[model samples]
Target: MRTIEVFADVLCPFTHVGLRTLVDRRGRYGLTEPRLRIRAWPLELINDGPLDPHHIAAEIAALRGSVRPDLFAGFSVDAFPGTSMAAFALTAAADRTGDPALVEDVGMALRNAVFEEGLDIGRPEIVEPIAVRFGLEPLDVEATSAAVRADWEEGRTRGVIGSPHFFAEDGSGWFCPSLAISRDDVGNFVVAWKHGTEAFIDRVFG
Candidate 1:
Protein backbone atom coordinates (compact mmCIF):
# COMPACT_ATOMS: atom_id res chain seq x y z
CA MET A 1 0.00 0.00 0.00
CA ARG A 2 1.29 3.44 -0.88
CA THR A 3 1.50 5.64 2.24
CA ILE A 4 2.37 9.09 3.42
CA GLU A 5 3.23 9.48 7.11
CA VAL A 6 2.31 12.77 8.71
CA PHE A 7 3.23 14.13 12.16
CA ALA A 8 1.25 17.08 13.33
CA ASP A 9 0.20 19.02 16.40
CA VAL A 10 -3.51 19.80 16.60
CA LEU A 11 -2.79 23.13 18.26
CA CYS A 12 -0.49 24.16 15.48
CA PRO A 13 -2.30 26.11 12.80
CA PHE A 14 0.07 25.06 10.04
CA THR A 15 -0.91 21.47 10.68
CA HIS A 16 -4.51 22.55 10.09
CA VAL A 17 -3.71 24.01 6.68
CA GLY A 18 -1.38 21.18 5.70
CA LEU A 19 -3.95 18.53 6.51
CA ARG A 20 -6.61 20.52 4.69
CA THR A 21 -4.42 20.73 1.61
CA LEU A 22 -3.87 16.99 1.67
CA VAL A 23 -7.58 16.31 1.96
CA ASP A 24 -8.47 18.81 -0.74
CA ARG A 25 -6.01 17.21 -3.11
CA ARG A 26 -6.56 13.59 -2.11
CA GLY A 27 -8.93 12.80 -4.96
CA ARG A 28 -6.84 14.56 -7.55
CA TYR A 29 -3.80 12.67 -6.36
CA GLY A 30 -5.64 9.38 -6.65
CA LEU A 31 -5.12 8.80 -2.99
CA THR A 32 -7.43 5.92 -2.39
CA GLU A 33 -7.34 3.44 0.53
CA PRO A 34 -4.61 3.76 3.13
CA ARG A 35 -2.66 6.33 1.19
CA LEU A 36 -1.93 8.55 4.18
CA ARG A 37 -1.26 7.87 7.84
CA ILE A 38 -1.37 10.73 10.31
CA ARG A 39 0.19 10.68 13.77
CA ALA A 40 0.41 13.13 16.60
CA TRP A 41 3.53 15.25 16.78
CA PRO A 42 3.24 16.95 20.14
CA LEU A 43 4.94 20.31 20.02
CA GLU A 44 4.30 20.94 23.69
CA LEU A 45 6.17 17.83 24.71
CA ILE A 46 9.08 18.72 22.47
CA ASN A 47 9.28 22.25 23.83
CA ASP A 48 8.34 21.26 27.38
CA GLY A 49 5.37 23.62 27.46
CA PRO A 50 2.45 25.02 25.55
CA LEU A 51 3.16 27.31 22.66
CA ASP A 52 2.02 30.91 22.90
CA PRO A 53 -1.26 31.09 21.07
CA HIS A 54 -1.29 34.85 21.30
CA HIS A 55 1.85 35.02 19.25
CA ILE A 56 0.36 33.32 16.21
CA ALA A 57 -3.21 34.51 16.04
CA ALA A 58 -2.69 36.92 13.20
CA GLU A 59 -0.94 34.37 11.06
CA ILE A 60 -3.53 31.72 11.75
CA ALA A 61 -6.39 34.10 11.01
CA ALA A 62 -4.89 35.05 7.68
CA LEU A 63 -4.55 31.47 6.47
CA ARG A 64 -7.91 30.45 7.88
CA GLY A 65 -9.56 33.31 6.03
CA SER A 66 -8.13 32.07 2.78
CA VAL A 67 -8.87 28.39 3.30
CA ARG A 68 -12.30 28.57 4.95
CA PRO A 69 -13.60 32.03 5.52
CA ASP A 70 -16.63 31.03 7.54
CA LEU A 71 -14.59 28.94 9.93
CA PHE A 72 -11.92 31.58 10.15
CA ALA A 73 -14.44 34.03 11.42
CA GLY A 74 -15.21 31.69 14.24
CA PHE A 75 -11.59 31.35 15.38
CA SER A 76 -11.07 32.75 18.85
CA VAL A 77 -8.39 35.12 19.94
CA ASP A 78 -8.84 34.42 23.67
CA ALA A 79 -9.23 30.66 23.88
CA PHE A 80 -6.31 28.26 23.56
CA PRO A 81 -5.65 24.71 24.61
CA GLY A 82 -2.94 24.00 27.15
CA THR A 83 -2.00 20.74 25.51
CA SER A 84 -3.37 18.53 22.76
CA MET A 85 -2.56 15.15 24.25
CA ALA A 86 -6.22 14.16 24.42
CA ALA A 87 -6.68 15.23 20.85
CA PHE A 88 -3.61 13.27 19.73
CA ALA A 89 -4.77 10.25 21.64
CA LEU A 90 -8.09 10.46 19.85
CA THR A 91 -6.37 10.12 16.49
CA ALA A 92 -4.22 7.24 17.64
CA ALA A 93 -7.19 5.52 19.18
CA ALA A 94 -9.10 5.98 15.96
CA ASP A 95 -6.20 4.42 14.07
CA ARG A 96 -6.17 1.47 16.46
CA THR A 97 -9.78 0.71 15.54
CA GLY A 98 -8.43 -0.42 12.16
CA ASP A 99 -10.20 2.33 10.35
CA PRO A 100 -8.03 4.70 8.37
CA ALA A 101 -10.98 6.80 7.34
CA LEU A 102 -11.95 7.29 10.96
CA VAL A 103 -8.43 8.24 11.91
CA GLU A 104 -8.41 10.78 9.11
CA ASP A 105 -11.79 12.08 10.12
CA VAL A 106 -10.80 12.33 13.77
CA GLY A 107 -7.70 14.26 12.88
CA MET A 108 -9.70 16.76 10.83
CA ALA A 109 -12.40 17.10 13.45
CA LEU A 110 -9.93 17.60 16.27
CA ARG A 111 -8.04 20.24 14.35
CA ASN A 112 -11.17 22.09 13.40
CA ALA A 113 -12.51 21.99 16.92
CA VAL A 114 -9.51 23.72 18.35
CA PHE A 115 -8.48 26.01 15.53
CA GLU A 116 -11.73 26.70 13.76
CA GLU A 117 -14.54 26.21 16.24
CA GLY A 118 -12.66 27.60 19.24
CA LEU A 119 -13.36 24.47 21.22
CA ASP A 120 -11.13 23.01 23.91
CA ILE A 121 -10.15 19.74 22.30
CA GLY A 122 -7.57 19.04 24.95
CA ARG A 123 -10.34 17.74 27.16
CA PRO A 124 -12.33 14.55 26.80
CA GLU A 125 -15.70 16.30 26.88
CA ILE A 126 -14.94 18.47 23.90
CA VAL A 127 -13.43 15.51 22.05
CA GLU A 128 -16.41 13.28 22.78
CA PRO A 129 -18.80 15.78 21.26
CA ILE A 130 -16.64 16.08 18.20
CA ALA A 131 -16.34 12.32 17.94
CA VAL A 132 -20.11 11.95 18.05
CA ARG A 133 -20.36 14.42 15.23
CA PHE A 134 -18.19 12.09 13.19
CA GLY A 135 -20.27 9.06 14.07
CA LEU A 136 -17.60 7.54 16.29
CA GLU A 137 -17.80 6.22 19.81
CA PRO A 138 -15.47 7.13 22.62
CA LEU A 139 -11.95 5.75 22.23
CA ASP A 140 -10.06 4.08 25.07
CA VAL A 141 -8.29 6.99 26.69
CA GLU A 142 -5.51 4.98 28.36
CA ALA A 143 -4.69 3.06 25.22
CA THR A 144 -4.82 6.11 23.02
CA SER A 145 -2.74 8.08 25.51
CA ALA A 146 -0.04 5.45 25.27
CA ALA A 147 -0.23 5.58 21.52
CA VAL A 148 0.40 9.30 21.50
CA ARG A 149 3.47 8.85 23.68
CA ALA A 150 4.80 6.22 21.33
CA ASP A 151 4.23 8.45 18.33
CA TRP A 152 6.09 11.30 20.03
CA GLU A 153 9.06 9.08 20.80
CA GLU A 154 9.17 7.71 17.30
CA GLY A 155 9.08 11.20 15.84
CA ARG A 156 11.91 12.32 18.12
CA THR A 157 14.09 9.46 16.94
CA ARG A 158 13.27 10.41 13.40
CA GLY A 159 14.63 13.94 13.96
CA VAL A 160 11.27 15.64 13.88
CA ILE A 161 11.59 19.13 15.36
CA GLY A 162 8.22 20.70 14.77
CA SER A 163 4.58 20.36 13.81
CA PRO A 164 2.99 19.70 10.39
CA HIS A 165 5.81 17.36 9.34
CA PHE A 166 5.25 14.98 6.44
CA PHE A 167 7.12 11.88 5.39
CA ALA A 168 6.73 10.34 1.96
CA GLU A 169 6.72 6.63 1.26
CA ASP A 170 10.39 6.87 0.23
CA GLY A 171 11.33 8.40 3.62
CA SER A 172 11.59 11.93 2.27
CA GLY A 173 10.22 14.47 4.78
CA TRP A 174 9.12 18.09 5.15
CA PHE A 175 8.33 20.46 8.02
CA CYS A 176 5.31 22.73 7.93
CA PRO A 177 5.36 22.31 4.14
CA SER A 178 5.01 25.23 1.76
CA LEU A 179 1.62 26.12 0.34
CA ALA A 180 0.70 24.23 3.43
CA ILE A 181 1.88 26.99 5.83
CA SER A 182 3.23 30.42 6.59
CA ARG A 183 4.91 31.78 9.74
CA ASP A 184 6.31 34.87 11.38
CA ASP A 185 9.93 35.59 12.30
CA VAL A 186 9.42 33.45 15.38
CA GLY A 187 7.63 30.82 13.29
CA ASN A 188 4.20 32.02 14.36
CA PHE A 189 2.74 32.40 10.85
CA VAL A 190 3.93 33.92 7.61
CA VAL A 191 1.92 32.39 4.78
CA ALA A 192 1.28 28.85 3.59
CA TRP A 193 0.92 27.38 0.07
CA LYS A 194 -1.22 28.92 -2.56
CA HIS A 195 -0.24 26.62 -5.46
CA GLY A 196 2.18 23.98 -4.30
CA THR A 197 -0.59 21.47 -3.66
CA GLU A 198 -0.13 19.74 -7.01
CA ALA A 199 3.64 19.53 -6.56
CA PHE A 200 3.09 17.83 -3.23
CA ILE A 201 0.56 15.46 -4.82
CA ASP A 202 3.07 14.52 -7.50
CA ARG A 203 5.76 13.89 -4.97
CA VAL A 204 3.52 11.76 -2.80
CA PHE A 205 1.37 9.92 -5.38
CA GLY A 206 2.52 10.77 -8.85
Candidate 2:
Protein backbone atom coordinates (compact mmCIF):
# COMPACT_ATOMS: atom_id res chain seq x y z
CA MET A 1 0.00 0.00 0.00
CA ARG A 2 1.17 3.52 -0.70
CA THR A 3 1.47 6.00 2.16
CA ILE A 4 0.64 9.70 1.80
CA GLU A 5 0.80 12.48 4.37
CA VAL A 6 -1.66 15.35 4.00
CA PHE A 7 -1.05 18.47 6.09
CA ALA A 8 -3.98 20.80 6.63
CA ASP A 9 -5.64 23.16 9.05
CA VAL A 10 -9.07 22.24 10.36
CA LEU A 11 -10.52 25.62 9.47
CA CYS A 12 -9.07 25.85 5.96
CA PRO A 13 -11.67 25.62 3.21
CA PHE A 14 -9.07 24.92 0.55
CA THR A 15 -7.96 21.90 2.51
CA HIS A 16 -11.54 20.67 2.68
CA VAL A 17 -12.07 21.05 -1.05
CA GLY A 18 -8.74 19.53 -1.96
CA LEU A 19 -9.33 16.54 0.30
CA ARG A 20 -12.87 16.09 -0.92
CA THR A 21 -11.75 16.12 -4.52
CA LEU A 22 -9.06 13.54 -3.86
CA VAL A 23 -11.43 11.24 -2.03
CA ASP A 24 -14.27 11.64 -4.50
CA ARG A 25 -12.00 11.12 -7.48
CA ARG A 26 -9.74 8.46 -6.09
CA GLY A 27 -10.68 5.89 -8.69
CA ARG A 28 -10.22 8.37 -11.52
CA TYR A 29 -6.66 8.81 -10.31
CA GLY A 30 -6.23 5.05 -9.94
CA LEU A 31 -5.49 5.16 -6.24
CA THR A 32 -6.31 1.87 -4.54
CA GLU A 33 -6.32 1.80 -0.75
CA PRO A 34 -3.55 4.35 -0.46
CA ARG A 35 -2.63 4.89 3.18
CA LEU A 36 -3.48 8.53 3.85
CA ARG A 37 -2.21 10.17 7.04
CA ILE A 38 -3.73 13.49 8.03
CA ARG A 39 -1.25 15.85 9.66
CA ALA A 40 -2.06 19.08 11.44
CA TRP A 41 -0.64 22.39 10.28
CA PRO A 42 -2.83 24.43 12.52
CA LEU A 43 -3.00 27.96 11.09
CA GLU A 44 -3.61 29.64 14.42
CA LEU A 45 -0.55 28.03 15.95
CA ILE A 46 1.67 28.97 13.07
CA ASN A 47 0.14 32.40 12.51
CA ASP A 48 -0.61 32.98 16.22
CA GLY A 49 -4.14 32.80 17.55
CA PRO A 50 -6.98 35.27 16.90
CA LEU A 51 -6.91 35.08 13.13
CA ASP A 52 -10.17 34.14 11.37
CA PRO A 53 -10.09 32.69 7.86
CA HIS A 54 -13.07 34.71 6.66
CA HIS A 55 -10.64 37.63 6.45
CA ILE A 56 -9.46 36.22 3.13
CA ALA A 57 -12.68 36.72 1.24
CA ALA A 58 -11.39 36.35 -2.29
CA GLU A 59 -9.68 32.99 -1.93
CA ILE A 60 -12.58 31.60 0.04
CA ALA A 61 -15.12 32.77 -2.53
CA ALA A 62 -13.07 31.36 -5.37
CA LEU A 63 -13.00 27.79 -4.12
CA ARG A 64 -15.96 27.27 -1.83
CA GLY A 65 -18.66 27.26 -4.52
CA SER A 66 -16.57 25.48 -7.10
CA VAL A 67 -15.63 22.73 -4.68
CA ARG A 68 -19.10 22.03 -3.39
CA PRO A 69 -21.79 23.76 -5.40
CA ASP A 70 -24.52 21.84 -3.64
CA LEU A 71 -23.55 23.39 -0.34
CA PHE A 72 -24.07 27.05 -1.14
CA ALA A 73 -24.21 29.60 -3.91
CA GLY A 74 -21.31 31.67 -2.65
CA PHE A 75 -18.85 32.01 0.17
CA SER A 76 -19.77 33.68 3.41
CA VAL A 77 -18.05 31.87 6.23
CA ASP A 78 -19.84 31.93 9.54
CA ALA A 79 -18.11 32.29 12.89
CA PHE A 80 -15.14 30.06 13.66
CA PRO A 81 -12.52 29.71 16.38
CA GLY A 82 -9.48 31.93 16.73
CA THR A 83 -7.33 28.88 17.13
CA SER A 84 -7.40 25.26 15.94
CA MET A 85 -5.16 23.82 18.67
CA ALA A 86 -7.87 21.77 20.33
CA ALA A 87 -9.05 20.39 17.02
CA PHE A 88 -5.49 19.44 16.09
CA ALA A 89 -5.04 17.69 19.42
CA LEU A 90 -8.09 15.52 18.88
CA THR A 91 -6.93 14.71 15.35
CA ALA A 92 -3.49 13.77 16.60
CA ALA A 93 -5.06 11.47 19.16
CA ALA A 94 -7.08 9.81 16.41
CA ASP A 95 -3.90 9.34 14.42
CA ARG A 96 -2.21 7.80 17.45
CA THR A 97 -4.72 4.98 17.18
CA GLY A 98 -2.88 3.99 13.97
CA ASP A 99 -6.07 3.69 11.99
CA PRO A 100 -6.20 5.61 8.72
CA ALA A 101 -9.96 5.25 8.32
CA LEU A 102 -10.51 6.46 11.83
CA VAL A 103 -8.28 9.45 11.29
CA GLU A 104 -9.93 10.36 7.97
CA ASP A 105 -13.43 9.88 9.34
CA VAL A 106 -12.81 11.86 12.50
CA GLY A 107 -10.74 14.47 10.76
CA MET A 108 -13.30 15.04 8.02
CA ALA A 109 -16.06 15.31 10.60
CA LEU A 110 -14.07 17.97 12.43
CA ARG A 111 -13.47 19.83 9.19
CA ASN A 112 -17.16 19.73 8.38
CA ALA A 113 -18.02 21.04 11.79
CA VAL A 114 -15.89 24.11 11.26
CA PHE A 115 -16.22 24.77 7.53
CA GLU A 116 -19.84 23.78 6.95
CA GLU A 117 -21.59 24.00 10.30
CA GLY A 118 -19.51 27.01 11.38
CA LEU A 119 -18.72 25.54 14.76
CA ASP A 120 -15.73 26.45 16.86
CA ILE A 121 -13.84 23.22 16.55
CA GLY A 122 -11.21 24.39 18.99
CA ARG A 123 -13.50 23.48 21.82
CA PRO A 124 -13.30 20.17 23.65
CA GLU A 125 -17.06 20.09 23.99
CA ILE A 126 -17.24 19.77 20.25
CA VAL A 127 -14.53 17.14 19.87
CA GLU A 128 -15.13 14.88 22.88
CA PRO A 129 -18.53 13.64 21.82
CA ILE A 130 -17.27 12.92 18.33
CA ALA A 131 -14.30 11.05 19.77
CA VAL A 132 -16.63 8.94 21.88
CA ARG A 133 -18.78 8.17 18.88
CA PHE A 134 -15.69 6.76 17.18
CA GLY A 135 -15.10 4.51 20.23
CA LEU A 136 -11.92 6.43 21.04
CA GLU A 137 -10.84 7.17 24.55
CA PRO A 138 -10.45 10.58 26.08
CA LEU A 139 -7.56 12.45 24.55
CA ASP A 140 -4.22 12.63 26.30
CA VAL A 141 -3.86 16.38 26.05
CA GLU A 142 -0.18 16.60 26.88
CA ALA A 143 0.94 13.79 24.58
CA THR A 144 -1.39 14.86 21.82
CA SER A 145 -0.23 18.45 22.11
CA ALA A 146 3.34 17.32 21.65
CA ALA A 147 2.31 15.15 18.71
CA VAL A 148 0.56 18.12 17.12
CA ARG A 149 3.65 20.22 17.46
CA ALA A 150 5.72 17.40 16.04
CA ASP A 151 3.49 17.21 13.01
CA TRP A 152 3.85 20.94 12.48
CA GLU A 153 7.62 20.78 12.85
CA GLU A 154 7.81 17.81 10.53
CA GLY A 155 5.84 19.76 7.99
CA ARG A 156 8.25 22.63 8.40
CA THR A 157 11.23 20.37 7.78
CA ARG A 158 9.57 19.28 4.57
CA GLY A 159 8.93 22.91 3.58
CA VAL A 160 5.17 22.59 4.03
CA ILE A 161 4.20 26.24 4.19
CA GLY A 162 0.43 26.01 3.99
CA SER A 163 -2.67 23.90 4.43
CA PRO A 164 -3.74 21.21 1.94
CA HIS A 165 -0.16 20.06 1.49
CA PHE A 166 0.28 16.53 0.19
CA PHE A 167 3.33 14.29 0.53
CA ALA A 168 3.19 11.08 -1.47
CA GLU A 169 4.81 7.77 -0.53
CA ASP A 170 7.58 8.34 -3.04
CA GLY A 171 8.69 11.53 -1.27
CA SER A 172 6.83 14.17 -3.24
CA GLY A 173 4.90 17.18 -1.94
CA TRP A 174 2.41 19.78 -3.22
CA PHE A 175 0.41 22.56 -1.63
CA CYS A 176 -3.22 23.61 -2.26
CA PRO A 177 -3.47 20.96 -4.94
CA SER A 178 -6.25 19.55 -7.20
CA LEU A 179 -7.25 23.04 -8.40
CA ALA A 180 -5.78 26.38 -9.25
CA ILE A 181 -7.06 29.74 -8.09
CA SER A 182 -7.09 32.51 -10.65
CA ARG A 183 -8.94 35.64 -11.74
CA ASP A 184 -11.25 35.77 -14.73
CA ASP A 185 -11.09 38.65 -17.22
CA VAL A 186 -13.68 40.49 -15.19
CA GLY A 187 -11.37 40.18 -12.18
CA ASN A 188 -13.78 37.82 -10.48
CA PHE A 189 -12.54 34.86 -8.47
CA VAL A 190 -12.32 31.64 -10.44
CA VAL A 191 -11.20 28.10 -9.68
CA ALA A 192 -9.52 26.39 -12.61
CA TRP A 193 -9.20 22.63 -12.30
CA LYS A 194 -5.51 22.42 -13.03
CA HIS A 195 -2.57 21.00 -11.12
CA GLY A 196 0.00 18.25 -11.37
CA THR A 197 -2.49 16.13 -9.44
CA GLU A 198 -2.51 13.06 -11.64
CA ALA A 199 1.27 12.85 -11.55
CA PHE A 200 1.30 13.02 -7.78
CA ILE A 201 -1.01 10.01 -7.54
CA ASP A 202 0.75 8.09 -10.30
CA ARG A 203 4.15 8.53 -8.69
CA VAL A 204 2.86 7.11 -5.45
CA PHE A 205 0.59 4.18 -6.35
CA GLY A 206 1.62 3.53 -9.91
Best by TM-score: 2
Top candidate by lDDT: 2
| Model 2 Cα lDDT, one tens digit per residue, 1-206 | 44578998877777887777666667576655665678988777787775555554566667656656643233335556666777777788788888887888788877777766667676878777777888876456787678878988999999997988988775878887677877789888788666676775556556
Model 1, residue 118: distance off in Å is 1.8
Flag regions of model 2 displaced more than 4 Å. 27-32, 56-58, 71-78, 138-140, 182-190, 201-205
lDDT of 2: 0.73
Superposed by TM-score, candidate 2 places the C-alpha of residue 169 at a distance from the truth, in angstroms, of 0.8
User: Which run of 10 residues does model 2 get worst, by summed lDDT?
Assistant: 70-79
Report the C-alpha displacement of residue 129, candidate 1, in angstroms.
Answer: 1.9
What is candidate 1's lDDT per residue for 1-206, written digit by digit as tens? 55678888878776777777677777666657445578878778778888787755776667765665544445676667777877776677677777667777788878777776788777878788776776666557677667777988899888777877788877888776655454558756545455666676668656
Cα shift from native, residue 137, model 1 (Å): 5.4
lDDT of each: 0.72, 0.73
Candidate 2: residue 42 lDDT (0-100):
70
TM-score between candidate 2 and the true structure? 0.82
